[model samples]
Target: MDDVYVELAQMYDKFGISDFSVSFGDSMLKYFDCMYPNETFKKNLDICCGTGTLCGFFKDDGIQTKGVDLSAEMLDVARSKYCDVEFIKCNASEFNDGEVYDFITCTDDALNHITDIEDVKRIVKNANVLLRDGGLFIFDINNFDILTPGEYNKDSFNGYSKLSLVQSRDSDLIKTDVKYYEHDKLIWQKSLFERDYSISKLTQIFNREGFVLDSCSQHFLDEKRSEKWKLIFKKVE
Candidate 1:
């Protein structure tokens, strides 16, 4: 199957992904409130949403929220967890539901997961279409520093279940080796890939599609110190 999360989806929520998503969603909500305190976001759409944890934050604020992802298994997990948030199965690059939203998010460094840069462009362009005029498009991507030649390793255990993750970066590509063990027996192992394009290049591409950078942050807006960057763009008329 093309969906890499087929097997991983079963154990994704138990792997601290949901916990991290809380902080991630908090960051977005904080930024939105800061930027548009006088106004309230009416609708939100999260592309590449995994388990709909991020959508919960918007839903809590009474905003109509929806999530989209390419993996059916991931969507299944999300649907089971978040009954209030609508979930759709489709590639972020090709999704066109003819519905407009006030805010669009594709966080979690999801852009890097698309290997083809053209698809990344398509995703951003499509976001522009799905966003109403003056709508916000927020997303994050791995920066050049993280996409350089490097290696990272980690191992974790949840009771009898163990997970080993080895991630490496060569040039612009990041490859991750994943191994899951259950009760001392290997259950599944695979390699996943991600690619990162430079922030400047993405800026130019988004600009061409009538999106202006509204804000960006690593630690602070316009600060470029961190390895991953969250960017906010406004769709222009």
Candidate 2:
């Protein structure tokens, strides 16, 4: 596993991550509304918050939002975007803290980075500890069925393109090769990895870790299962 994000941190917003975050954040707000109805969240924690994108959304909604990420470089970008918000540098497995939150989110396939199942279990335990009773944990992951492995694809934006290849290894992990181009010249390249876990397995783990699986949607509440699964977990005593 390489810290490809260290190099991509500055260009992440240009790489389409920010827009995707905004769109995904909208769906999360909708899901929260569906679950809580008239309730208001007092605090929110964005686990593995890359550029503080989702945190921005929560802040805009009047929720006190704080973010944690493993990359200081990524947090630099996030701080630049929202100087008022707090962005802490820390790994998911080491996120033990005294503060409790009403809402927690790990979006954009952040959990998949923990290839080890035990590490993932640790994160679940930490989530249970950090969340107040009835708090919600929302996250999304790459669904192998939709993001079928293969090839160098192109994602174009603002007259630039990111050429990338996604390969699914036999070990149940997915590897991504990303290259950014400017005017047809290579600017940057990165390698990223994601672990694949079946929805059933994740649900079982959540149950074991003291979370109740509230619901799951592909992308949005109304959307069908597609390239990813947006899962909702509620912490209960």
Candidate 3:
């Protein structure tokens, strides 16, 4: 495991905001329904499924779901809360099993954490190998256009909860600093770094991995430029 991922996994719960999952899950389900209205899938894989939020949602909707993440700590929390679902600790960039999945998802900018474009391409290729024919690949990424110009840096207050976020971008790295406050007291702070890749680059990589682009939608909840754009790809040919 990468040192950064290992460290972040330990503080995953403290820095992670659960509220975001509610809206994210709804959007994901909407896309899933649109793509496969009549199909009934027996097995689903949520790759890089931090805290297994999507897996929990799928289980609640009566689907058999399994989650994979790089962090054992996060998987522990996911397993403890969602006992019905299986959570495996594994790196998304290089994961393989003998079985194929009906659907595979890597959501919430999970792919951005992978530093190398070649690695991203490898992961997509592996995902293609792991999916049954016509299986859907749905994921999202924080738009570089939004983050490069440092538009995500700002302070917002909500009653007793206050949030401050800052972003720094250079040639090879993009770093985000976040601080959470409650009752006017500092609660926690986290620094997250992601490797940057343009949308065009990602699209090309997906194409090379045998995925046909389907749809791309701007993130519905947030209006900020740093918001995510949801993308759906179909395994074809």
Candidate 4:
């Protein structure tokens, strides 16, 4: 499949998706802190970490940070934005660094983009291998339970860009259409397709990969949007 983020990277930062990532990550990390009281997160790895915004936020908080993504174009943007972050280009399911981290995050429903169940399982296993004992891992997903054919979602980023999505009524696929504008002049347009993963199946994979579900929330920045979910897991084995 073609790399969607790479095509969007040129105009991605203008959309302020980075800000949403940090804000969402703050909520998720706070939940992690509450779940694992007294746990100090010293190192973090953001998987499928686009634009490295969350990693940048982590760096600002004095945490050692690294971000991994498959798209080199996206990494170029991330590196330019946050030079301090150890941005690596590799498939999330196949990423491995010699060092283990105390905290790991995969945000923005990135997991759902993997259409293969085996690859998703590999990503979960990699998380277990990447985290230290009792480390916390947080990730978000677009809920599969309530997903229906023809479901549509859209969001605008302060007049810089607009993203529109529509789900196929015949399959678990989603078609994303994004338009970027510079001073009201259309600059770029792109379309991409993604598949949504079943939440129950993902939980089962997490169990087999040595992770225990620690928390779950449907809130996106205080909005109770049941169609979205963020789950926190702990490495227990």
Candidate 5:
């Protein structure tokens, strides 16, 4: 499974249809600046930092940043392009360090990649351990309501780039089957699995992990879509 994730991670930036991190990170930085006007974040970490997309944003903001993922191939690409930032290949659910971070982010719905509730608990617990007192943990999840409704299994395109997506939802599992074809040739295909959690269930997990929910907003900073929510959780003192 780890090797498969690594292979997908290596080709993600090249073959994946969406570049959500660029826009998502932009919004997060704005939120961070507005919410923490006087705060200074020296060290930051991006868990499940596939291709280091968000790490680029942190670097642009002059924050000393590091990235970790279970995919060594992904880290290799990130290291080649962003040599200044450190990249660690590790499992999100079991990572630890003697040092803690001032800020941490796990974006692109990476949390959903964990298909088990216990795995989610372990990952969040590890995140808690990696964060300083009062440090922030930011993440996002696809709304199960929208996902289960079968709206995601659609054919869409952005000019020349066409995307064919298939979604399967079960009692506790959500799977996405994606096939990307370009120039009439099949370029990529991947099956991604994630656990389904409501906003309330997510809140419960965060509270149990001793974190405060600062904000939860749906969609790309817009309420109209309301199909996905980005949440910010802060470590308690």
Candidate 6:
């Protein structure tokens, strides 16, 4: 499972089709401004922070940022690029440190990679433990409304050398296959799996895990887009 991500890490940034980096940065800033109003938060933790994209943004904003991912290969690339930001290799569902953070983010549909509901609960519960009171835990997942309506079978290209195919095995499970090429020859191929859970189910698990649901919006900062849902939760005091 994770080995796929390892193979993909080297080309992850180049393979991104959407303007996700810009949109994500803008969304995070909007949320941060809304939460702080007059001050800046101290620390941020990015879960499943593949390639440490968001971590770099947070660091540029002068926030002490740390990232955690299950793939050591991904972290290796991240650490190689970002010398200041810390990138730790650990499971998002059970990873923990003694220190708590002011803000946490797990974007790019990272939570959807956890196929088990129990694992989702563990991840949320751990987020509660890892956050201070009033601290935010923001994550995004594939909207079940969008995911279950039809199969996720699509083909796309990233520039010239990278090709991607997304396929759904069932309503709940999605697989993304990527191929990289040099000229006409295939260099590598990799596949990654993701799972989708209903918003209602997630709300129940979050509440049970001692989190107060703050909001759930589409596209993070935007309310109009209908594909992804960004869920915000705060650790109950």
The lDDT for every candidate, in the order shown, is 0.79, 0.81, 0.72, 0.76, 0.76, 0.76
- Model 1: residues with Cα > 4 Å off, grouped in runs: 144-157, 220-226
Per-residue C-alpha lDDT of model 4 across residues 1-237, encoded as one tens digit per residue:
346676687656665556667877678656656655677787889998888889888888788899998889989999999876789999988888789899888887787777677888888899888999888778888875576645343355565445544455337766666555545576666666667776677778888989888777787445556666888788995
lDDT (Cα, tens digit) per residue for candidate 5, span 12-73: 67554226776777777777677888876668888888788789778987888888887778
Comparing 2 and 6 by lDDT, which wins? 2
Give the higher-TM-score candidate: 2 or 3: 2
- What clash pairs does model 1 have? none
For model 1, residues 1-237, the per-residue Cα lDDT tens digits are: 235598878777777655655666677677777878986678889998888878887788777899999888889999998887889998887888899999888877778888888888898888888999889888878775744544442334366887777777777777878788878788888888888677788899899888999887776433336677878889996
Over 104-163, each residue of candidate 2 has an lDDT whose tens digit, in order, gives 889888888878888889888889989998888888888876666787555666666565
Residue runs of model 5 more than 4 Å from their true location after superposition: 1-7, 15-18, 148-163, 182-188, 219-226
Q: Return the top candidate by TM-score.
A: 2
Query: Candidate 2: which stretches are off by over 4 Å?
Result: 152-161
Worst 10-residue stretch by lDDT in candidate 1? 148-157
lDDT of 5 at 120: 84
Model 5 global lDDT (CA atoms, 0 to 1): 0.76
Better of 1 and 4 by TM-score: 1
Residue 8, candidate 3: alpha-carbon lDDT = 45
Q: How many pairs collide in each candidate, listed in order?
A: 0, 0, 0, 0, 0, 0
If ranked by TM-score, best first, what sequence of candidates would result?
A: 2, 1, 6, 4, 5, 3
Better of 2 and 6 by TM-score: 2
**Poorly placed runs, candidate 3 (over 4 Å):** 1-18, 148-164, 178-190, 219-226
TM-score of each: 0.89, 0.91, 0.80, 0.85, 0.85, 0.87
Answer with 1 or 6, whichever has the higher TM-score: 1
Worst 10 residues of 3 by lDDT: 150-159
Tens digit of lDDT per residue, candidate 3, span 1-237?
344444344445454553355466676666667666886565778998877778888788776788888787778778887998888877776777677887787777878877777778878988898888888777778777754554342233334655566778888577777666677687777777787777778889888888888777785434333377777788885
Q: Model 1 TM-score? A: 0.89
Decoy 5 TM-score against native: 0.85
